[model samples]
Target: MNSATTTTTKSRALRRFALHATSTCATQAEAYGKCILATYTDVRKDACKEEFAKFGACLRESVRLPRK
Candidate 1:
């Protein structure tokens, strides 16, 4: 491919990597949140559920961002 095409492909790849990294970081945060929630017996299950929901929402929102 030509230089212009290569550059565009590279840019897209970089953007994908950045988004993947952000999602991964968010996943790590959710894991840590679950650990904190696990410490409390009363709300442990609900806390874990909420953490998963929050992570899902983050991913969904990220997908919608570039559309607007």
Candidate 2:
């Protein structure tokens, strides 16, 4: 496929991972923070920045999950 398609797929995966990590966090806040970074930082910087912001806004406004 093309670069746009590839980026979209990777960004979706990153958002999924971030949500999973955050949702499954235990008592420790640091662990959750680390998980967010490990799962999303580079992906957001590379190809998911716009999508990430949209995802985050939706996440905050409601319980809606990211679209595939």
User: Which numbered prediction scores highest in lDDT against the true structure?
Assistant: 1
- TM-scores, one per candidate: 0.36, 0.35
Candidate 1: tens digits of C-alpha lDDT, residues 1-68: 56998999889877865785476457755675766766766664455665666666665555453755
Question: What is the Cα root-mean-square deviation between model 2 and the actual structure?
Answer: 13.4
Off by over 4 Å in 1: 1-28, 31-33, 36-47
- Worst lDDT window (10 residues) for model 2? 24-33
Model 1 residue 61 CA deviation in Å: 0.2
The local lDDT score (0 to 100) that residue 64 gets in candidate 1 is: 51
Note the clash tally of each candidate: 0, 0
For residue 15, model 2's alpha carbon misses the true position, in angstroms, by: 0.2
Residues 1-68 of candidate 2 have per-residue lDDT tens digits of: 66998999889977766664455332233443455677764554335454455445544544345489
TM-score of decoy 2 = 0.35
- Candidate no. 1 TM-score: 0.36
